[model samples]
Target chain A: MDLERPLPTPITPECRPYWEGAREGKLMITKCRACGKPFMYPRVSCPFCASRDIGWVQASGRGRLFSFEIAHQILNKAFKVKTPVVLAMVELEEGPRLLSNLVGIAPDPKQIRCDMPVEVCFEKLTDEISLPMFRPVGGAR
Target chain B: MSDLARMRELSNAVGIVGVDESDEIGTLPGKSQLTLHVEAITNAARDAGIKVSEIDGVFTAGQHSPATIGEAIGVVPRYVDGTTVGGCSFIIMVGHAMVALYHGLCDVAVVCHGESGRSGVGVSPRRDTALPGQFEFPYGFGGAPTYFGLITTRHMHEYGTTLEQWAQVAVSTRKWAALNPKARNREPLTVKDVLDSRPVVWPFNILNICLVTDAGGAVILTRADRAKDCAKKPVYVRGAGEGSEHVMLTQMRNLTFSEATQRSGAKAFAMAGVKSTDFDHIMLYDAFTSGPPLMLEALGLAKRGEGVHFFAEGRSTPGGKLPINTNGGGLSYTHSGMYGIFPIIEATRQLRGECGARQVPNARMSLVNGMGGMLSAAGTLVLSNEGSR
Candidate 1:
């Protein structure tokens, strides 16, 4: 993917690992040893227990579509060409949900429903950044 | 003791003495954010029959600081607060102002909000480096419509809420807008009209979203004793609560429900010793059509997934069992970025019986709720004209 129109994520110390992992086609989540729980949106401490014993674990890259929107307007100018995109919230089997885009599926209400099975597919946007977007498993392309 | 029992001292302790808005709303081409603040605050002081020098406390949020507002308004306030939570920041300021007055920090407190949301004169800086911009914005989650649309989609999935049900909220609010002479879009809207409007995002069309217009309003609070001498009938602050559990949308406890509202409204209702039925008028922030229903459900005004029916059944519209958003709401009324103060202004009008055409008949109690940061923070106020003395 050579599109550079949309804004890029500014890698920070806390979230660098998650972005780096996406480049390597890996989905990452923060797991806390103290609470034995997993969560998304990397943070220094466990959101559940406030424990500093946090570690990065490879997510299953498999989840169900929790909910989504078929945005008719292209919010970011970079993605101006991709009008009517499907923005989705995928709830990983690990009990945490993350916001991402949905590919390999039509952006239609009649076609999409909640709890649809999906799998992560990394798409490199820049040399240092790759977004973890999801697609319907064993569904349309 | 119950929260209500413990709240007796605070209940009716601080009364809202005055409410005012900037002279120009919708499109004030030359007016900047700072000017709007000073204009609204000055008008509020005049409404209360007080002078700018007498306003010892100054409160404001969004794109401006209290120090700047105080300097501009010619007040060297003893108490100042700049709580910028989001669109609901001014509402949260009310709760803070009440606390400050209760603690004897200030006698005359003025909470103001102004935004060049439409003119883009002095908007707040974008936090692209922040959590949402870094994580969600990259995925095309740009503004309120996209995220709120996601919320509405989830709500529909969980409760089997139909698109028409969501459109009904717009229809009912438009009816109220037609009554409000100052409402931006007073034209009658139907369910089909909402459903057929330009699509901004899934589960939402242009009509389902709030219009971005330049506007601002202010509320003045003082000790109940002093309120008796004010120019307007004192609308006592019967109960107030503010809650913030998360700053990001993904971190909410539940996507289908608003925890902030649940927490804030519970405290407000308990402190007021009243239930949903006690309110003669209600004002839930309608930044999006989905907001009112979600707030209603969270505040226990409606059962889970039954909020949309409150409108579909005509219970929340004009001449219904419950009246809400009589000022046309942010949807049809003026929405200058932070809309928390607009509802406060309308609620005050209801309690004072000053709303000419849109008044809730014999209204003595009004509930006003404001939400900020993608439903991240919530502030609830129960105002009453009945038991101030």
Candidate 2:
């Protein structure tokens, strides 16, 4: 009864390590080895100095929800039933901002506010990947 | 790089020999997007008394791909540029093309644009790219309503600009739309109507957004000496300016005001030797209703926090003075998604006294602005009835 699992969204050579690390339930961010400024969304070059001396480090997976919107409706036809999704951009405690889906909260527009505290939880959608979704520290179930 | 010299050189070099448009577009049915573009192009060339084969350069920007338009227009340009910003892009691209023509890149350049933005041409239900910001769109970010919502929230938080003040801009542009026969939202819109409109995003209602429309516009530019031989009045390209910063609103720093748009305008005004007060009427590209008033503050037409003040007083509306966006803008006018190109078309027509009912009584000089992305890329242009040789 052995069946091969589905292939993950083929990660490129430049971004393989980030994926491999994510499977370990660790979210990683890149920074220039020369300068310590934080970077998001794994890039080939350092945005700060345009330097290629980039390295990845594990994030605390903790952040503040800088800005957010609770969507009561889904825009795309495919995601039509997935209404009430809270899409948020979180400014990590490390000073790099990244966009993520805010889980564990009532997806109501009236309740969300800026500067709310949140922590990351990895959802293992596949054996090769774990998505970094966040939830309010004391959010609606 | 600034296009001030290019604007003057264009005025002294090639001139706009043609002025024309679509048949007052609303929701045109039974017409393909490409068909609409070709119709506008042929109409403009015919109005200019020129043939399609004679056009050496053809440009399409914003949403329309250069390859798609070049194939549709039946003319392969020696030079092609498809810089997607907002509607103001065509105006800036015209400035760049003038510089290229000065270098003998191409001769008769025609700027054309068409899109079924309202119809949503096969865009994915999810975000398009794996760009750094894909997660935001699923939650309904980056739509016209959302982008302006972000700006409006920040503006209110920082400067205490009120929602009524934001509504006033929609109110003022609609007043101008009422006079224009071509304007889609001809019925006058009150500030209350704008405020009462359903909120797509917080602080932004439906009236605050540009309508998704199927429309097209075209303009012809050629040698100044040759322009005099054509059938219509040639509005001189006085000064042109352009600049860019970043694309996504979440990524850009200091979203307080559009520095890039203001800077582009400053360069244009300085090169043209005209202040904001010098222009008789302005033909700024208005994608969302918030764009015009924000531009008023950004371009120094009104002071900071004074953008709302400029509109709330009723002085900025119509008869009080400092008339703007006489085309009803994208909000009330045709919003083909590439809105910048149409302002140039309208400015040329207005300067030529072609605007029948919407004509500004004695419009002499016009300042035009094109805004692309999340106010990331911008272009400002100056056009004058004082045609030069």
Candidate 3:
């Protein structure tokens, strides 16, 4: 198992656009046409109003660090080299939070703070899959 | 009738006549998860002094069907419930059982849970295979510890909750473990010990995480009136309610507190016609050290962001204002993956005056809170001695 690449997530019909967008360097979120509520972890319908009239919108690719943890002991063998991995929850500027990895910075609590500004960075793991990771904006790695 | 009124009508309509566990609480390597369920169910039936055939309703949470359980137990249940959320699934089943008894859907109900969390003998939910797996797994969302670690981290960042406050939870729970002969880890623990423990996930050391043991438990419910005919005194279910917001932790609107717990606790209290202050004992599921404070806030016993303060103040510890988790909790007791059932059993034991050393003095009422699915699902139960109401 390569530490640089973990297992790929199984794509479903509802989330195919999300992966496709990541591959194109665009972070996608669903906006409900009826209620105008936006959400992540893609959906077939608006989670709030159950609106079928949903469209994919490019996210600002900017977010804030809501919370994070430095997994000192890697649970997944695929990320063994990335010990002390920065697993984080990034709340998008558009109003939904999604789980992602924080890169381009030390995986230390002293370096990470809640509400820190972050921008999306895509990691092209395969021809079809690209993981959306976040990094501290203008911060030293 | 309003939902609360309907719940109130069901309140105390059913009583828990029996509660028991599998042959062991921790590390039964040779036993299968199904065997644990059978053992627990059989023990509960024996404890209730009722034949297995009397159970007209069979309910469980996670990975198993009523048809499978009924076939194993050798009875065809008229009603079946398999509501799988996570650890709190069993607690939610109890609430469902009360309604079933009240509505005459079944005369007797058995709620069971069994897991081979440590042994790895049973089927466990694979987050990597779920719909969100595409988003979660690749980035190292391993399981409960990482998921809960994020909540704990955000809570600390928001509430100024310190590491010592988290460690204090482990310290206090260990004191409770010292009194229970069945508890796995009974040694004295200190804040320093917790802080010094090896890290599994950030903000959570080995002591902060629940022990993964293989165990199972079951509880039997019957109509309150029929409970009088049982050999053992019944622990009346005065109130019960369940709620869920989201299964994934990332989607939770608020990271500092659980909305499901607040809703469920409020509904349970309203149905029981009581408040948080009325309880003689409390049992909040302790899957992780961070849970107690968060749950305390959700239950309205403590203010938001003050859960750590509430726990640090020694309010929930032994010889304190409100005795909690007298069975040592999942922190020091057995946590066979889903820890919801043990608290219900402990609450029942406390209400019946059956806990010898760990007994709450003359305990008339007890509150039990069970959580599941990354603090996504919550079930609260308000129970009392038969005479309390």
State which candidate, 2 or 3, has the greater TM-score.
3
Q: Residue by residue across B248-339, what tens digits does model 2's lDDT show?
A: 66565556588888889887787677788788778766766667767778889878767666665446566656667778888887787777
Backbone clashes in model 1, listed as residue pairs: A5-A78, A6-A78
What are the RMSD figures for all models against the true structure? 1.6, 4.3, 1.7
Listed for each candidate, the true contacts retained, as a fraction, are 0.65, 0.10, 0.73
In candidate 3, list every pair of residues with a backbone clash.
none
lDDT of each: 0.86, 0.71, 0.87
CAPRI quality of model 1: medium
C-alpha lDDT of residue B362 in model 3: 91
Instruction: Supply the DockQ value of model 2.
Output: 0.21
Candidate 3: segments with Cα more than 4 A from true spot: A1-3, B124-128, B387-389
- RMSD (CA, Å), candidate 1 to true, equals 1.6
Error of 2 at B369 (Å): 1.2
Candidate 1 on B141-224: residue-level lDDT in tens?
877888888789999999999889988888888889999888889988898999888989988999998989887789999988
Interface RMSD of 2: 5.3
A43-132: candidate 2 lDDT, tens digit per residue: 799878888899999988889876654444434442332555566767789978766677887765446655678988876756666667
- Clashes (candidate 3): 0
Q: Of the candidates shown, which would achieve the greatest DockQ relative to the real structure? A: 3
